[model samples]
Target chain A: MDSTPAQVPEGEDLERRAAELHDAMLVVDGLQYSHWNRGVLEELRAGGLAAVHVTIAYHELARETLSRIGEWNRRYQVHADLIRPVREISDIRRARDEGRVGIFYGFQNCSPIEDDIDLVEIFRQLGVFVMQLTYNNQSLLGTGCYEEVDSGITRFGRQVIAEMNRVGMLVDMSHSAERSTLEAIELSRRPIVISHANPASFHPARRNKSDAVLRALAESGGLLGFSAYPFHLRGGSDCTLADYCDMIARTADLMGIEHIGIGTDLCQQQPAEVLTWMRNGRWARELDYGEGSAEQPDWPTQPDWFRNAADFPQLTRGLLAHGFSEDDIARIMGGNWYRILEDGTQPRSA
Target chain B: MDSTPAQVPEGEDLERRAAELHDAMLVVDGLQYSHWNRGVLEELRAGGLAAVHVTIAYHELARETLSRIGEWNRRYQVHADLIRPVREISDIRRARDEGRVGIFYGFQNCSPIEDDIDLVEIFRQLGVFVMQLTYNNQSLLGTGCYEEVDSGITRFGRQVIAEMNRVGMLVDMSHSAERSTLEAIELSRRPIVISHANPASFHPARRNKSDAVLRALAESGGLLGFSAYPFHLRGGSDCTLADYCDMIARTADLMGIEHIGIGTDLCQQQPAEVLTWMRNGRWARELDYGEGSAEQPDWPTQPDWFRNAADFPQLTRGLLAHGFSEDDIARIMGGNWYRILEDGTQPRSA
Candidate 1:
């Protein structure tokens, strides 16, 4: 629980050097669930984000999820200059070249598919790149991180994974339990992802992945996105930027640097009511305080060093100060995510 | 138009014989858009309907269409005794054995899929057994009957047809323009269907199929369900039972008897506003009277001989008096639809 920032090179030249490096790298955020608007898109552009995987569904059924997608479609139409929808890896490059942010859709839960397996392809065709098998509780597909018993993937879940593999939708296990996450990594033919979770050994949060799951995920060529959410950090809002970078470096040592990237679970500008909806969704009659106490069931305060998309450059500075090379910094920023996405988002050969 | 009833043996025994024949046959109505409720389900059972392909979408996008399916799912749960959802052909036999009506969902327009071709399989997995290519106007897939210029199936429509064929959803072209209908039949690898339409030669209505389309449909092993809609009838609401039977007999001659079956197109007990929604849906600012005049924009009055499901037996007797054998009557009633359903509702081998 060390909350102090480690000493780093304090010259203005070093700070300017970090900013220039951040501008040069193709930075990508693996997951973000922000209150999207033109302002948010502009902020992402300011942060030099080439692409971001945005969560559009947590517990929404097919109808509600499609409505959310329609809303995003409208946003893409209106903010054509600031952001564009991402379907292929080339779209990310185009975003970088155009100096805009590419918004890639992801689902934090499998609720959007409901009871039908074919909806996986339907969502993929609609440009959903990543889909988690479960959220924070039990789903039809598998047990979630908050569930007491960790039952592996269900029979229908296996069928869904196969269909997802066939359609080239990347399987995510961000909020899945240990057993379920391990099983999904083994079962998916293509490389899976933990789009927005840190190593449990780093902070011991229920939403974090265990070392065993991380080893399997890395061995299978999957990606682990280091989360910046306060609850998943070591010292909540008091955790220092230097400490966060150190954790990322440690994780890179455990699971190779190729499998490590940033997925700052940023819930920027979302109202507190949305968090309640995310946790309860229509399943619970009572408020389920997921990661927070009943007395304070709200989004935890983000550390000042990483409060929003605009603060992503601070992490690049912290990593550079931690003695990581410019090449390693560039890979951690977005290159690794781009490589995994290209490998995972194409349909399997017949 | 001939309005006279054909001569028949006048006796209680002949009346008893027709009733016995109607009850013995596997009566299937290929399409109906009734205000579904327990009362309507009871009437369907009373008519000895083993299965009825129910219209669930017209100009609805994906979200609205999924909501409609959710509503039907609720109906199936609440009225389990009177009706059950149909998926496979065996569901029809199960319905007949359980003495409940099998409700097979279909779409009168391809709107449920919106712009995504993968939704074809998604809707099929949701138990939508049939999906028409268009309604009374142009769609993403093809041109409808009411369009002045018949632009046949588009490029995306071809992909949708292949997906629908692979997923076992019957491609319906009942309300499509002639050229589009012909193109759909030609492009579909599996047998396509015109789930509800009469011959244009029989009535010359804009919504009716042409002789060339019917010939192609039959030659491709597709079924054309004869419509009982007054607008498509020769004499509107005054059409006689004998004339309707003769139209069926003539159609059976044109397309083989194996390709002709009843589709009724019955719109029983629906409020007039629903008709406006069907014709307008979100696309129009002004109401579009599809078949009826603007002054009388309402559901057309059903003919006296076929006012509701209860009047099905009258048509059975009329067919018998038209010199059709008992075996032919049985085939016309439901056997033909069943055979085609079995062929068109199973997924094609990879």
Candidate 2:
């Protein structure tokens, strides 16, 4: 259920304007880990989303990645008012125009890439512009941010970055190790991204970035997608939209406007079954066979970010109230990322 | 070791220019989680950082957070050429002007608040402008992104948000949960922030925020900080600077200009001991008793983003290559954040 009308302090007029603007915007969320279901898609529509980057590489997803994509495709047809599977920039553009959300098929880890460079292109052709070389655990690429022994990016990671660049796929370093992130940034011919992580300025856990790292990313022309995980913020679980906007402003101050964008890594509609599996540690475990040892502890499971995706408008209203300009709001909402897709996803000229 | 310069591609000139610009830049990384040792502080100066947000609430920083602050103060005095502990916004400004890397006192978790509302003011008075309500685990305020069970903001969290507002401290939600983040946004009267984290456009892990989340943040007139962790990005560990910038640009396109800033969350100066503690789950354990199991199993352990803090120029060069405007670049490089700090840290009218 939506927040109570009594709880919604925004007047009906503000709500109306917010709804109008949200409806007109071409919104594209980079990552949505939620399980696909009618309720989830409905929430997407209710939130006025234009497109979403869906992940199909978690352990549970590993077995049925392709089948899930097909299922979503069928679902898209059934829910034409709400969703459209995105396969390219054109698909995203078309979806934005038609008021249908474009579904971009992306993998959270290479469990599906399964050590094949060719699969990288295959996935890219299927609309996986962004790909993380590793997941929570270390893999053929390198150690993840949560790992204890971080040796840096591995040889496989080098190959993956190269392949990703060759295929016009965007390489994400959100959960990667610090060494791997730095190495990837310096090694990739194309600009890479830390699509979803927090600044080390505020928090120093494995979950955030350092000022030096942000500078390195900015210098490399990579984008730092600011995240809104509550624990990472100063206010903990009690943070508000002003908190999220404050983060955006701080990131913009550090990375500059042209390089800033929004990547709210939401898990909408994914059922408890999947979330439960995530708690069990299969998702990160699959990334590294060695990490499955008895000594290695599983990820500390946690509740999913909002229960679902229907609450996007609240996010919009929050940003508007935080003092973001209409144009800047549009860019952060989707335009800056649209440019990235246009430039980064295109095949390189020989 | 740095990448082989002998393998210098045709873009060597660009690299040189980036390095020069980065060196000349009044670069101020928002936070550092390194142990307050000479080596780390030296590294900060080596990177030509104008200021660094030194942490006083990491794992090993237990009960001794005040000592750590005092240590930074002493170090700043001793390393006068290299560092100066900052206690106010103006102090940071002075550090930037003086060519000495400013040392801003910060806390990764509000455990330092130790269940006291007035401590918020005490810390703020001590130059703790940036504070994360929780670390990797939950606290009295709310849940951390890594907690197995995330309860939205507790009553204490609500009070924390309000107190932060009353005391003129910037609220950071980088490690928080969605419910808490949303709640903080709604509860706070001032512009709150998620200082660092990736855009949800790519990674769907708990650590990242959704596009809707970032949009909501921008809508609320707050800022979304882009981060540097790689796993949070699309292609886990293989991300590059271009991809990073793309994420930022995406947010900027959607959220508008003023709602963006850099909270780089740099942990460059952290000692190996601290890294070990952070990686060993001590940080989160310290925050929440009886909790602090390993991070989600799917999440990788600690992965370093870089060897140290000297590589900031690489990020700047990459951003310049990506076609970011100079004005926009300046904003991302820290101009916009200064404005936000001014707005967020203003003294509340009693």
Candidate 3:
């Protein structure tokens, strides 16, 4: 619960390298939806994070999503010393160079596009770099993982993927159904991402990807940002950093070292109501437990080793201990995500 | 194909009584979602329909549904001579006496309520008589017929049903999945209606009810409005009047005549886009060929015997020809619907 970074464990000699590696890396979390404030902003900087693909909307429509973007614009204005917008992929490098945490916009659901295909470009122009095909239910474009059937990419989904490719909006399928996710990988012209999910081989969860989907994603040149959210981990909140890093290593062996990275799925300092909004939206008149069970129907506790943004450095230390090479560690930390963004988030035709 | 009523096959005298029977009875069609205009209204009047539960929204949100209601309000003003809004159950009698087709507002989907439980009362106050829990896909309330699985009645669904019961909104489960529909029948304190569907025994379509559901519905004192929509018929557009009536007769034997009526899910004089809007709302970015397949995705042809609202007399003739007693024919025509609405659509507390 402490905001301050805990000191590196045991040997003072080993601490030097962990601190140096954390400082050297451009730590980019592929997804986080924390309740943004000046306090949360400070934590990302403390964690040595260069860029983060933060969720701007879950089930919001175009106009509502625009309002959320405006709110973030206000945050950028107020916290100029700590944060800047990643309008272009280069802005991330600029933030890393200047020591500000770069904020890149992403949608957890396709609601921001509504039914208008034109909004894909409009949002890309507005600096939204990543968009998932569906959140956790069937959407206009494709079926979400929570749905009964996995009807693959809809006709509109096919067109939207093309538009997202043209406009440089990276497709994210973190919460989409299996067939839809597989089809999205095959369908997208550019590399897609499962922005924040662990492998089902790591933890057989509804939200996790199959070995087949992960392999297809890697073959299609996609990135898989390993989720640190406990429910997707082997032992839920009790999952140790070693177990977490081990899952990443196994996933790397399957997906190739170049395709793996840490997303964490951190939702720092969010109220219970925000959790309700994300789970239920306007779709349910009743409570939808979502990833949580009825008895455990609130946000699950994040693992102690990875509680908030400030705990991100622990991931670097844990990965090093798990025997990944320095270059692989750098890529798994942020280098791979940065490489993907350089090509993926640029207007190809425009 | 003709607008004028054709002679009841091989019996001129039977045709005269069919007209008289249609005229003498209330002749309420439980559901109709035609693209309303002066022409469509004229057809309802020609059919001698005393009241019609007309769909005002398929997948419209609260504000959108309110706007739809506003559009209907405009129709009441423009077509006052031919039609009037049915605010109360007794409004049906008033319209019957006045020789105008009473238009009762209904929603084919629960989208109008959005996530708010209070909108159930708001819509009821606006003269919205019926609201289906789901259209053809999973919703916040319940699973639709098209979903691969059915997790019956969400927490919100239970609350919405109770709110509906308190506020006098008739719960209609015409397009919900089997478990959701069955759960709704058992859960609802008041009897629910399947406003537009046939027995699975007749057609065995996805949208049709099973004998188990139909029997439970009848046992619960509910009603089943036989849909004349061709996809729900045994022989599609070629189904004869005798075949249609025989299906009804078999259903009547199973369900009792008092629990049956006509819905004739008519979509008259509308462009193909309306069908797209109904089948695939904003939820589907692609064209969802609901009820119709990819090859035969457009609106299926209405049977020749029941092509339009003006063809209501043909149903009476067919039922009479099927040897239903005059009392049973009266019940099947409109009496049953009127009886149910008398108690089902009044706010119990109010």
Candidate 4:
């Protein structure tokens, strides 16, 4: 249930051009919170996702969060041919040379730090480069989108912001509240990010941010990796490539193209039951329907036009049809994210 | 410096009656997060605080929270004459009759729950009847006042709210953001409480609730325990008793007398350095001035009129001088908290 652009450049020529451009670009997905395995890793490697921010925590505690990191360490050992852990920006290039998907560790919540602020530095040492202060709920550092009121960053949050900045961890406010997101942008000495959320205007989900947040994000030198998760898309799984690209084009008008990238939020090869661990996270005795209703509570069907990592070419083709310059297409594809990753994760000198 | 109420109802006659009334009433302070020792418990007993919600965790992990509860159990055994643990709402009266301050366990943040939802019921069983979804910052359960954006109740937050509701663990949102607080009110089947915060109209701290939140809290049958924290007062430590009462009276007009009570956030006998644990916790590597400025970044001076638990009589005197009837004054002073605590902490039949 997808449509081509209103005027796609005449047939196979466009498809061939899109494939070449995608292959040539440094394609990066800022978030991948999947129940990933060898098969999923293989898909990413085959699809030319040169770099990815891999989620290792949802409602996990500091020790549990560390265990997830340990699990990834196991994955790196077993799937060395397909994936490599990217500890530094230069490592992505090294990974690409080796023809592996370069993955960086991230956390959806600040559970990894728990109450100890020193854990911020310890986590960075463990290779967790990007962390959202809150997932969908309120985190220790700040408010999430789902709390009743958007309490701004806590006093402790101010210290975390400075510590993260000093320690070289990029702050991601993808699931945070409006005031918290804006305050985070202003608070961080470094650029922060809304790694996987569309504009709220694009879809009325509270998970999506607002125009004001996007503009502030851009002004603060932050990134807004347009989400491809069905919940963030206008029509869910029925959303067309054209409609999704239209959203990106419109958002680019508000936030410059240079601030935009892709974050699919794709939970590939994941069971619907895995969603329980995600949405409920041992936090509920009863079942929780997060984005889906009780009648259809499961993983949403990814849009046919952009189903998985392999569908990157369709995105490139759609962008070209939207009249984006080849350079802008490259930037949106991965160039912008790469530049920011370099600046955002650079450790401050003593 | 303490100023007398603007104009008294004549002199010793009023003071004598207020003291007699205070002596007879069930004075409750909904929050007391302090570095308490046996001496502090003695102070509470001497002050005639019949019931008090004593904080056990700020940023402690689940096991650590249990240890604090264990420590309280020790206090109950050693200083049984001065303090008793209040597990049931009926236990408050027992404590009053016994001439001891009935102490209930509370957590400022949901750290005690960690990632386990089952901990809600376990904590309730352990006699933690009250828990704030968040402290001054974002928590796993919901948003805090200090975040930049108020993401609404999260998917996980929805579950936590429902579970807390089902388990009879009262949700306290004293430090939550506006939207999160409102959503928690709607989400919980039972009424939640903002256990310690002044109305935003009283002071402009991010820690204060707005009129909309206060109204919603009242309409939802929740309680508003007016905070005596200097930062929330009109003039910090210089706040006059009359000004504090005026804020309460104006709030009463809006919220009605039945919904309001006193939550003197009195960290009695806590040394200035303890503010570090209360404000910064271990989360910040750098010094964090939560409410205080860098120049005066320690414990704020409590207003002289209400310096400790010793000042409960002064609050009753102040309320009486504000033209409230004695019955209404009782509700504002402690009866509302009592009534709400009864309804809020009752576990449902299996």
Model 1 Cα interface RMS deviation (Å): 7.8
Residue-level lDDT of model 3, residues A195-218, one tens digit each, is 899999889999999999999999
**Number of backbone-clashing residue pairs for each candidate, in the order shown:** 0, 231, 3, 41
TM-score of each: 0.58, 0.45, 0.51, 0.51
Query: Tens digits of per-residue lDDT for model 3 on B1-350?
Result: 12224544537777787778878898899998888989999999999999999998998886566557657765776788999988778888899899899999899999987887766765675678899999999999999999999999999999999978977888999999999999999999999999999999999999999999999999999999999999999989988888888989999999998899988889898888999899888878777898877898788888887889998888888887777887889899899999989889877742
lDDT tens string, model 1, A299-324? 88999888789888888888888879
Give the clash count for model 3. 3
The interface RMSD value for candidate 4 stands at 11.9
Q: Which candidate wins on TM-score?
A: 1
What is candidate 4's TM-score against the reference? 0.51
Instruction: Compare candidates 2 and 4 on TM-score and give the better one.
Output: 4
Off by over 4 Å in 2: A1-17, A60-64, A269-273, A279-307, B1-350
Ranking by lDDT: 3, 1, 4, 2
Best candidate (score: DockQ): 1
- C-alpha lDDT of residue B344 in model 4: 78
DockQ, per model, reads 0.07, 0.01, 0.01, 0.01
**Alpha-carbon RMSD, each predicted model:** 13.7, 29.3, 20.1, 23.0
Please give, for residues B1-350, the per-residue lDDT of candidate 2 as tens digits: 12234333537776776677776566666555655567777777777676665567744332345455545544654677777766566776688677777777667777777765656765575567877777767778888777788887888888888878876888888888777778778888888777777777656767788777687787777877666654566655456556677777777898886777655555554444445455444444443322123463222322233346666655566566766775676667666666667788875742
What value does the lDDT take at residue B212 in candidate 1? Answer: 94
Q: After superposing the true interface residues, what Cα RMSD does each candidate give?
A: 7.8, 24.5, 13.1, 11.9
For residues B144-232, what per-residue lDDT tens digits would candidate 4 score against the true structure? 77788778778878888887776688889998889999999998889889989999888998788899999999999898998888988
